[model samples]
Target chain A: MTRLRFAPIPAGLPATVPFTGPETLERRRGVPFVARLGANENGFGPSPKAVEAMARACAEAWKYGDPDNHDLREALAAHHRVAPENIMVGEGIDGLLGVLVRLTVAQGDVVVTSDGAYPTFNFHVAGFGGLLHKVPYRDDAEDPQALTAAARDVGARLVYLANPDNPMGSWHSGALIEAALDELSADSLLVLDEAYAEFAPDDAIPQIDPEDDRVIRFRTFSKAYGLAGARIGYAIGPAKLIAGFDRIRNHFGVNRTAQIGALAALQDNDWLEQTRRNVGAARERISAIAQDNGLTALPSATNFVTIDCGANGDFARKVLAGLSDLGIFARMPGTAPMDRCIRISCGPEAEMAAFAEALPIALAKAREV
Target chain B: MTRLRFAPIPAGLPATVPFTGPETLERRRGVPFVARLGANENGFGPSPKAVEAMARACAEAWKYGDPDNHDLREALAAHHRVAPENIMVGEGIDGLLGVLVRLTVAQGDVVVTSDGAYPTFNFHVAGFGGLLHKVPYRDDAEDPQALTAAARDVGARLVYLANPDNPMGSWHSGALIEAALDELSADSLLVLDEAYAEFAPDDAIPQIDPEDDRVIRFRTFSKAYGLAGARIGYAIGPAKLIAGFDRIRNHFGVNRTAQIGALAALQDNDWLEQTRRNVGAARERISAIAQDNGLTALPSATNFVTIDCGANGDFARKVLAGLSDLGIFARMPGTAPMDRCIRISCGPEAEMAAFAEALPIALAKAREV
Candidate 1:
């Protein structure tokens, strides 16, 4: 047998998927989930204008997308009130994160992030052989100060902090993020992942200068914009660092339909407002359901609500398994403390109703177990 | 000014785009091309069934694409008569190449390829700090023997060969490719890029063992399948190597619309057959046009035709410029010898007529220059 030669980093790594998609579970279970709330995908759907644009662009699928991503970047520049050079659009935040890690983290380089933060980001860091120094979350939020201190302590190259944190649905005020930046080492670049920013309160959205070389902010259409399947996202940062992406990125990687659809979605402010309203309503409904089932719903600044099952990680796992058995696809944090909670995405009325109906039965089964 | 920390490899590299897309040209020229023949895109377009499926999937753009690409991989496995484990779906051939390079090539790792083969592959190699040793094309064809010799000499970890070669539209028989593999070092993996396989003649189609660990074959829907804008492709290889992709790839990177569209496109064998016929006719038309313009068309087993201008690289470049000025987007090889030819993609009748009309004027302009 011919032995394949893989780089030392990849060879040492296990073939592990960062997250098992809900579809894989469906295949394993032999039944589709009644409410697709896992993966933090927006179930409210994308704008009608965006859908129309994508559907229209289907005939033009033969042409490769603009390698420069010109028009969309220009539109995004106008939307953000920054120069186009400040924005670099990519396949998604996931894709951008991989590139960012590659750009900064060489093998054995130190990096910092919250312990139970985005596994996809961690996956990229590990894939590149970066030495990860994970700081524990503070009170369910991705503590910016902790991340900064860790970066400084480790002499880290990159530090990641996701605002409106995942799995816990908690957030820090923008001022806190800015304050934390002051303590960050000059050599360490802050990777501010604001994927759920559009769904967060204004106080939770940071106002970093576009020219700030110390930081790069990642934003995506997947969350509140409801174009998750389109796979479009952008990173905002100093022009110099943004230009670095062109050095290594697959120039024509972004899908043309995604470019057209994201632009249309960005233009339809009415649709965005309506979706926000829908998400807010769904969050309330989910929280209400959680309270009725004798669980405490965390105060969420993002689209998802994390409900405390009022038990340990094992008990929460049993509850999660029960929910899966009852055809409600949900997820939880991978580590302790936070693992006591189950994360559920905000969806339409029917999905919320389905979750509402299933939660009690799942909780009852978990108690029995 | 704060100095951003980039890894040594990326920091030393200049930010260069591999290719300047035609859209960038259009924006610079302030007009869309009359004949979109550049970028080797299929002007014949995708199957109607694919367009329909994509259109239907537009509403489901809220859900993330299945990370496993389960359905598409199953269909592809059936089509190729291989197990699903042997197939690894990615964003595109370009995206897959990036991952492949990341997996195999570390900094200063030696790699080999034909000098003027796909620039995107070169870009990925350089991006990963791989030391590329270029072997000149033998008689306008990618000399597999030369590539193998160079890989053996340099102790290369990876060797790239685009079958049905790009830019020159040349090809070798499958038997020759199989025979060349015998000389390749066991340590050097052959990166067989069959992006244009659908357009190749039967003799040029290589039949390699699916479990062969010495080579990994890349295939794409962006070519004959007419889904370039969709950005979908797959790599067929030993299950071990295929599984290694899961260690580093963006699990949810492939777009949902692309998955649905490609599956539909694959099922529509009649559309593919029709497309092949269209491309063949266009090749003949393009050849006739070249003959009329006092140029010699190279024998091609691909959708595009490379027309030798019977002059040096400069003359052909001048001719390319003239064609661009005439609202015809065409391309040429970047290196010498092969650069004497101008490449044109197969398009519909109207585009053919436009190219035919513009060639004489462009030639006249080139001669004057």
Candidate 2:
């Protein structure tokens, strides 16, 4: 029998999930997690208005979503004070990253990202046959300077930096990012991922011009907007650069309900402000819980708190395993010394209470191990 | 200011929408179409149960969807009597097609399809640098033999055939497709798009083993199931070929509500059967409407009817324009001989009555033109 042939890039790729989903773990263990504090998902949930909008949209589920994403993009543009042409809505930040990588990285192209940063970005780069150059994080923050240097040295096509970074929950100021942009190679594109920007301090986001051709920024409704399951996000960049996405993006990838829900979510500023306060309070509580367990929690500007186990990667892994065993779903960084920390997402008071209750036992188990 | 460099393939491709959405036209005209009968969407709407499921899922929208799509894939596998490994769910059939093309079609790779067949498929192939070979329709139906012959001659990597073809709404017997498989080159993969299979006769869909490596079949909830706005679809193929998708698919691309909505839609077979009956009745009514205008309505195995305008492509364009002026959204094939007809989708009695009232005026306008 003749065998089907896949392109060399995909054929050689290891079948891997960039991040293990909480649901997958539950299915494997045959039990639901007690506190779903992993995956950095917003647990306070979408604005009540967004939920109502989704319910309303469900009635019109027969019509395919507007392929142009006109209304959503227009609304986003108004919110951002940018031209609609500067925004391209997509399935989510992950989906946008995939398309961005496909649009820039050809076989044997070079890409730069901090070591153990967003693994999904690496997955996309590798899927398109781009060679990745890893720059070690500088003091647990995504070292934008090192990333820029690596891009310049390798003549990389793309460089990735996540502000208010994931796993570590550390952030860089807007001034630092603007300075890093000056150092970014003209030929290279800086993929500034601001998925967690909504949770970050205002100064953490650089006031870059929407038409900055050298940089593309991704923001998502999945994060602070609390619509991760809706799979809605957008890239803000120069008109010419943004137009490149139209050449290859799944135009109608954003669902109708997602569009409606996100629009409603954007309109509900009071709910967003309330969720931000909730996340801030939750983060403090998580830090306090970590301190109680004799762990040092990293200062976080995002929704999640990354707690240092005050031990090695192995010890941290043990603690994470113990937490899993205790039915609390939390995650850790992929590489050291970041791997010495376990990340926990903010959630409702009950979930936080569950985490608070489980932490001590998980720590004791890790210590015994 | 420094400019960023894009991959040659995307940079060279034109920024064009493969199809102009109805919303775009509405925006352009500054008014919504009175009867949306253009995009082949099920105007009868999704099963009420699916809408309820979506509304329910909206409450839990903060959680990211299961990246593996485990439950839905498992359910779909059971529904198809295939193993879960043989199935891959995606944002939509359009999304799946984009990925499948990316997986197999490298730059300059040859792909064969019927002329004026699914422009989005051609758009994807071109976006990925695949050379497209178009075979003219044989008697308004996609000529499977011609497609196979073209694939063989071009050493194509992929061949696309939409059974119960779109735009023209023509179809072939399942035995014919099975026989045409013999004519297909051993090395080429057949992309069997059965988006309308739910509306087709039994003989129109061949009973191929799910493990068949030479072919991959795509089905969607967008048609008779009436969940197009949910943006969910799946591809069935051999496990090996299906696994290739894992290397590049946006793991959590399928929205949580979409997964819930589609699953609920699938379980409501009564709604589907009723939808089929409604579509059949609508098709007959459309044919009568065409007869009233002294035009010929092509027999359709799908939810839409393609009516020959009883004149040339120019005349059909005028008729379509007149319909648009009369606030009825309709579309026609983009390429030659096929463009001589206009396509209208199935809708409720009110929409059908609107079409009936408007057809004669549109025809008169076309005659005057």
Candidate 3:
């Protein structure tokens, strides 16, 4: 018998991490990456204003962050043109998702997600002892209508859909997502994770009433805004559900430096636009490179490109391993059909050049496998 | 009827917050205090090296921090003379508390704490639908003997005790705590929150087998190292229990700047020692100030001193508000007998001088009240 025991959920929880970070992979390999393009982190960097703000705040690191997050909330409210009550800032969308899961899910409670959706969300559901039922994606695209039906079928407490979804860099427009929201079953709360929302086209986000309670939208500065390291994000929903987060959240989970950096970042619209433009250019470059290598790249509205590897799961795994051998850090989809694709993040020109140079050798090695 | 509603447990949760930060209180009072000596935050500041590290790290703010916190965990492991598996870094003790509560506490599970202990712990229990019971502090300190009995009586899922306790600043020697550990009931998991352990005497920390799993200890850089703004702290326990955090924790919850800043802070032993000395000296100054006003200051081993106003709760509140009015931010305990004391954090010479200059006026105002 194990001398020490954990509570049931944690006891049954396999010690499997949601994702093995590239740094861990590097440590195991004993070599750092030549081109770090995985995880969809913005390589364009944060606004100088944000950097300066953090630098200035560093001297005052002895003080805890303002627990209320008043300044940042007010600033986010002003920037998003929404009331401060409509926004709940947190450690990141990852942190916000955990709280949402706790609020809605109980032991054996039903939850729904796309089979190949964000693994972190699945981790939360399983961690909470929620019975997770996954609907398969239709052609690497999240079938929202099917997801809604599954929620009704299972009588799920929550349904999650990530727009411009990760791993595949696929998307459906705001109009379709709004239609999906309308189709959601009454008993099910919709968690529309828009972590990559800022990178999508202007019309991609639905113009919903801020007071609507059926869905809570998760947004983060981690993607196109290039503040991933800051660990700051916000959720927008009706005050009733939003207030529930305050009941369970780590009040000071968001660092004081993050609060200061995010506030500064939200103010620098010029830098955001420039970064978005850079992402667009990099996507085009990556797409062209994929085409030259005889791989089909998915049209993306995200900060990364997911290229179809033109083979089965094993073949794609070989390609991924080969890339790792070439000192290029990239990732692939966890589930098949989607597994026949490899994802690459936008990076600086130097890193992009490294990717272009490394692809042919990596592909040849995959063929040998 | 509400179209969207949370589970009954979540809906039942209060909108109550933990501690109201000084910033919030400042905003409420329509002015910022010149001397912020509230919340027990270290005012001596983080190590200069940490600030320099943060400034250098600013350019890469766009990249996501290592989700595994690899380098940081390695450094901390070396510092504590333990394996990396023994430590689980988090946003702070607050974040870890939330996770631990979720892992062990289910609806109606019994959780025990001191009557006037950290309110945040009570808040988490309530959020998780746990039954919360409190034991009164015996003779102005947390009585481990009572705590053990309460845990056994309630069959508590968890029992918490903070060494060099917050709000009170009293401590028990490690020998006493170690003795208490043996008497602790097996049903309840013992949580020794050592947030202020650095301020305690050398013998105050019990050295147990690092491989032991029945108890967990949490430590933070927020106190003596003065890096509260970085939001970094850790829980050390058995490998199995420590690894359990991955199943429930937000893998990327900790911020990048925090990792960089805290790593540098940990290496600066000189700064840590100097800050401890500064906090000690300032504690003496604060005690002297309290005695000057004809009140008794409780003996403290932490960064803050709790002064008995020697009057009723009403008198203490009046004095706290008066201090606020005089641009000095200080707090008082929430309960009646403890409310007879007002808490003040040790700070820079300027802030301490401000407290000394303002105490008499505040006391006079309190007397009139």
Candidate 4:
């Protein structure tokens, strides 16, 4: 029998998901996690107003969403103080990143990123046949300077940097990122992912200049806005770069309920502020718990906290597995050195309590191993 | 200033939407559409149970949908009497098409489709730099034999066929499609888009072997299931082709509420039966309306009727403009011969009455033009 032929890129690629979702673990284990914190999802949930709006819009689900995403784009533009053309809404940062890579990264093109950064971006770069050059992280944070230098050295078409970086939960200030941007090669485009921007301190977020052609920043409702399941995010960049997305993106791909709910979520500033306060409290409590367990928690600008396990990667792996066995879902970085720390998302009191109760037991088991 | 460079494919392609959504038209005209009979969306709406499920799921929106889409795929598998491995759920058929094209089509690859078939598929092919070979429709229907012949001639990597064809509302028998499958080149994979399958006669949908490597069929909740805005769909094919999607798809792309709603919608078989009946009645009513206006409605096995304007493409276009002027939203085919027909979606009595009342006026205005 003749086999279906795949393009060389996909044919060479291994079938893998960037992250193993919590549900997959639950299914494999035959039991649901008592505390769900693995994926950096907001535990506080979306605003009541957004929830109400989505519920109300349920009956109208028969109509296709505006392929243009006009209202949402307009709202986002007003919120960000940019022209509507500078903003392109899509099915989350992951989806938008796929389109961006498709637009810029031709086969065997060079791209640069810090080691152990977002795997989905790397997956997209590989899927598009881009050759990725990875620079080591400096002090457990994404080294923007190293990334920019590598881009210059490799003639990189794209460079990815996650602000308030994931896994390690460390961040660089806005001034530092701006300085790094000045050093970026003119030919290299910076892919700034700010999925956790709402959780980051104000100084941690760089000022938006929509006219800048060398950088595209992504923001999402999945984290601070509590709409991860909605799958809505936007990229802010030069109009020309933004326009390039329309040439290849699925125009009607944004779910209508997601668009409407995101709009409502955007409008509810009080809810956002309250959620921020809740996250701040949870972060402090998590740090205190880490200290109580004789572990050091890294300073974080994002919603999650990464704890140094006071041991090696194997010990941390054992700790993570033990936590899963104890019905607490958490994750750690995938690479060495950084993998010595386990990452846990901030949630409400109950989830925090679950984590606190399980940590010592998991650590004990890891020590036994 | 150096300009940001796009890869050659997108650089050469025009930034255009395949279909101009009705919302775009409404924004331009500053008037809401009174009858949305365009886009072939199911006006009867999703099951109330599905709507309620979505509404309930809105609170849990902070969690990412299971990237595996395990439960829904399992349900779809059971419903179809196939194994879960045969099904791959995605954002929509539009999204799945984009992924499929990316996986199969490389630069300058050959693809075959009917001249006036779904433009989104064509857009994807062009976006991927595929050389498309278009075969003309025969008797207002997609010519399967011609498509297979063209595929063989061109050594096409992909051949696209929309069963219960769009715009013309025509279909071939399952037996006929099975027969045509015999003639399809071994090297070519058939993309059988059965998005309108629920409304199609049972025989119009071919029996699923789940082992056939030459064909992959796409079905959607967007049409008869009435969840177009929710943007959920699935493809059933050989496990190898189905597994290939995991290598490149956005694992977390499917919205959580959409997955939940689709599952609920699938379980409500009674609602689907009612919707089919409603569509059957609407088809009759639309044909009757066409006769009243001295137009001819093509025989339909789907949720829409394609009305022959009894003139050329120009006349049909003018009639479409007239309908737009009367606050009725309708669409027509984009190519010659097929372009002489205007397609209308089935809706409730209110929208139907609006279209019924506007047809003659639109016809008169069209004649004036």
Candidate 5:
């Protein structure tokens, strides 16, 4: 056998996937998913204007995108009431997280996050050889205080917190995040992921100064803007931190169509308001379905709802499997207490109807199992 | 000021750009270029089918792309007559090179490449803290033998060689590469970048077993396929080496429109054939333009022609500046010998005519300078 040399860090790391996409599952099951509600994606899709912009951008696909991402950053800055110097656009939040981890975390460096928080972030931390210090979620919500305390205790260089957190779909106010920032170690940068901030309540996102070097907030076009497939996101932070991204980022990584699509999407606030209303209705329907099936749905500020199966992790896993078997795609958290609930994403009426029809059968099957 | 902590590697690296994109130049000059012939992008654009496919994919933009890239990978595998396991898709060759460097190169590890060959490759190596050992180009083409010698001497973990070399538009036969492989150190992995392979001579690409653990081949949709803005590229290597990407890659990184567009682009062989012919004609016109200006155009196997300005590197630099002032975007290399030549990418007739009209005026300006 030829000796192939992979660096010690990657060689020791296990080949793992953070989340299996719906397409993979469909291929494995030899059937198309009746309702694609597993991944937290907007089913109403992007605005007609954004779609038209992307379609138009396709003809100009031969030209490389602007490496500086000036227009997109300027537009994003205007939307956020921040200067362009405070923003950096990248492939997506997932891609940006990887770059951020690469920028801050070194081998064996300490990093902190909620135990069952976004696994992709954890995957990035591990990929960079960061020693992860995980704190347990508090009552389904990621405890900002606990995360900050852990970061300080561990002398972590970075701490990750996702407002309107994934898996459990719970959120804390911006003031809570600011308080957590105060508690963080002086040297520890708080990575505040607000990927779902658009769908979140107004108060859920606190007004933090972009000049604060202690915190960098992430937002994506994938959620309320409804351009998940475009793979575009941006980070807002101190000018110095944003400049540092230039030293290591794939400068032309953002797709040109994505930039154009996102720009047009940002301009279409009417479409955004309509989608938010639609998602609110869909979330309520999902909650009703859970209630009818004798389960309790956690109050959500994002596009997904996590329902307590009124049992252990095993029962919840069975419920998820039952949903999968009935052609309804759903997901559960990766860790303990959180695994007691199954998560469902909001979609259009047809998809919600499919999930509603399967929920009772799935619950019955889970009880039998 | 708040204390910000970045990793030791990034902190030590300089914030330098690999290429100053045309958009950046346009913004700086306060005028758009009449002919955008820099950056080596295919100006003839992607196939209409690809454009149609991308436009169609916009409606389905709600869904995240398959994390596995299953369909695209299968299509690429079939095209290459290799198993899907042998391929790994990424944002672009530039993005993949960064990941590849992260996977194989630790701090202070030795990496070999031709000096002034591809600045982006060097940028990736420097970003990852790899110690680069650069061998100068021989006769405007990458000297594979010298690269292998340097790798053996330095005990390099990786060796990078671009087959149809960039900037100079020169190439080496596949047999020469095969011979170089024999001389490479047993433990060193060769990264053969074939970004411009489609436009090269028939003998320039050698047949190699997909299971060859000693080599990894990179191909991009950016050049001949004209999807640079889409940022899709794939690497073919042994299954083990390819699996290593899973340990650290942004799994859902590739955009959905890119996947759809590239698949359609790959299927349109007639479009590719027409493009190849167009590129050939454009190269000839570029050569004629150079000859008309009392310059020697280098024999090119790629989509661009490098014209010797009949003086030194300074003269060529002045010519490039003159072109820039005349609203014609063109590029020259960074190092000696290669720096004496200005590189111009092949484009449509209108762009070629614009360059043709501006070449003499630019040459006269350079002479006055």
Candidate 6:
């Protein structure tokens, strides 16, 4: 029998997990976390309208959803004031990113991203055999200028930047991103990930010409809209580029319930505002706690806050372990100085109270370590 | 701005839509299908437990689903009586195929499948730049011997076959498949898709050795289980191949609602049995309707029946259009011989009566054409 051999490209990559899901840890430890902040999930929960829509759709679960995603795409287009052809709703931003990479990238094509940017994007680039050139983060935020420069240097076809980014919960303002756009070579496409955009300040979102084929923007209902479990997100770009998704994407990838839930979530802007307020208050409380423990909290735009322990990455790791031992699940960045900050998602009072109860002990334990 | 260059591989394929969904046609025609017998969807709906679970889980949709899919995988592992390490769940069979092809097929690699097999799988193979080698169906059923010989001759990395197949609604029994397996090389992975396994006769399903790495089997909730909209499907194989998914799969691809929905669907065997009964009745009625219309119905082990229109592909296309005109949506195979048959899904009285009403008109229309 001939032995199966993986392609040379796939063989080059190590059998490494893209991200460790919190559920895996819970199963291994035989205990669920009392407060789950590790994955940057919005513990605030989805809107009542979204919930109602999903619950109501339950009875008709047998029917396959409209693969064209007419309702959701139409709603999204209206929301963004763009034509329906310029929008493509997918399983999630992650799923959409995979497809976008597939369309443009071929073997050994150059792609640029922040050094510790969203690992999933890197995973997709590598999955398609793209050669990734990473620029280092500046002050825990993605340096858009550097990303653009790297793209030019590598003659990269795509450049990715997650505004109000994950892991560190830091953001680059809309103006900064818009300014950086001019630096990108026309051949180097810009992918502005606005997954956390709904939580950003009003001025933090960049205004791009929807017809501009050189740049594409990604948004999600995962954070402020609170429908991550529904697996719904979308990308906005030039009609031609957006339509390219039809060539290879799983047309029926986004579930019907998810589409309904996300549309309802988007319609209830009041709920989004409330979640933002609640998340802001929680972030403040988290910052105060960090300050009390002699640490510094990074300025944040997303639902999660990253706290600097005023020490090395190892010390922050100890503190994170201490919090985990106390049943508060939080995470930290993977690379360099940014790793010194521990990330905590904003949830309700119960999670806030859990953090308050655990932090002092974690700080003390970290001192002992 | 410089125009984005699509990869050479994608350029080879047309901007073709493999499935023209009922919704698209409805919107284009400005009316809905009174009976949707097309696409082979299980019209019986999902289990009561699954609906209730999803309903109850509505609010918790804020949280991202566990990327590792711990709970569902554990449940699936226990159900299959295999180690959890052997199971890997993705968005659906479509997503899994995308990942599998990425792993095995580099540019110009050979892939083998039936001429009129699942178009989506062929789409994925083409998307990944694999050179597809097609073997035509023999006797209205998947020709296992031809597939086996072709895989070995072509040194194909993958060969796809759906037992109780799609479009033509045909099947080769479990013993025949097992016999065919003995002739395959290790390099050629037999992709045994059991998406409609639950609907198949008990004797039609072969007992598989999960430890045998030569084959990867896929199971889904989209058919008899009635959770197609949930976008959850799993593959079972050797741990080594299972672990390979970790290298590139979007970790959080499967949503929480999907996991919950599928889990609840799997737990309720009563609902599955009920759906099977209903589906069986529907299939018989559809077959009877075909015979009444002067057509010969092919044998089926699925939740759909393929009716021979007793003429050429053109006649079948006219019949299909006639059904569409009558607001009864149905489809037919694309290739020759098979295209002579019009396909109708198993559904309740409402849809079946519509088919019955529309069949005579469609036949007359075909004669006129």
User: Quick one: best lDDT, which candidate?
Assistant: 4
Model 5 lDDT per residue over A211-314, tens place: 98789999999999888999999999999999999899998898999999999999999999999999999999999989988899999999999999998899
User: Please, what are the lDDT tens digits per residue for candidate 3 over residues A1-369?
Assistant: 232565678888888878878888889899898888988989888899988998898898888888778998888778778898888998889888988888778789899999989999999999878999999999888888999999989998899999888878888888988898898877888899998888888777887776877788999989877888888999988877777788778887778888888888889999989998999999999999999999999988799999998999898889888889989999989998899999999988888898988888889999986
Per-residue lDDT of B127-201 in model 6, one digit per residue for the tens?
A: 888989999999998899999999989988888888988887788788988988898876788888888888889
Question: Going through the candidates in order, what is chain B's TM-score?
Answer: 0.99, 0.98, 0.98, 0.99, 0.99, 0.98
Q: What TM-score against the true fold does each predicted structure earn?
A: 0.99, 0.99, 0.98, 0.99, 0.99, 0.98
Question: RMSDs, each prediction?
Answer: 1.1, 1.1, 1.5, 0.9, 1.1, 1.5
List the pairs of residues colliding in candidate 5: A174-A206
Which sections of candidate 5 miss by over 4 Å?
A: A1-3
After superposing candidate 1 on the true structure, give the runs of residues whose Cα lies further than 4 Å from its correct spot: A1-3, B1-3
Error of 1 at A50 (Å): 0.5
Stretches off by above 4 angstroms in model 4 are A1-3, B1-3
Instruction: Give the local distance difference test score of model 3.
Output: 0.86
Instruction: List candidate 2 stretches off by more than 4 Å.
Output: none
| Predicted complex 3: CAPRI docking category | medium
Q: State the DockQ, from 0 to 1, for candidate 2.
A: 0.74
- Consecutive 10-residue window with the lowest summed lDDT within model 6 chain B: B1-10
| Candidate 2 residue pairs in backbone clash | none
Alpha carbon deviation, residue A243, candidate 6 (Å): 1.4
Model 3 — TM-score against the truth?
0.98
DockQ of all candidate complexes: 0.77, 0.74, 0.70, 0.79, 0.75, 0.72
Q: TM-score, chain A, per candidate? A: 0.99, 0.99, 0.98, 0.99, 0.98, 0.97
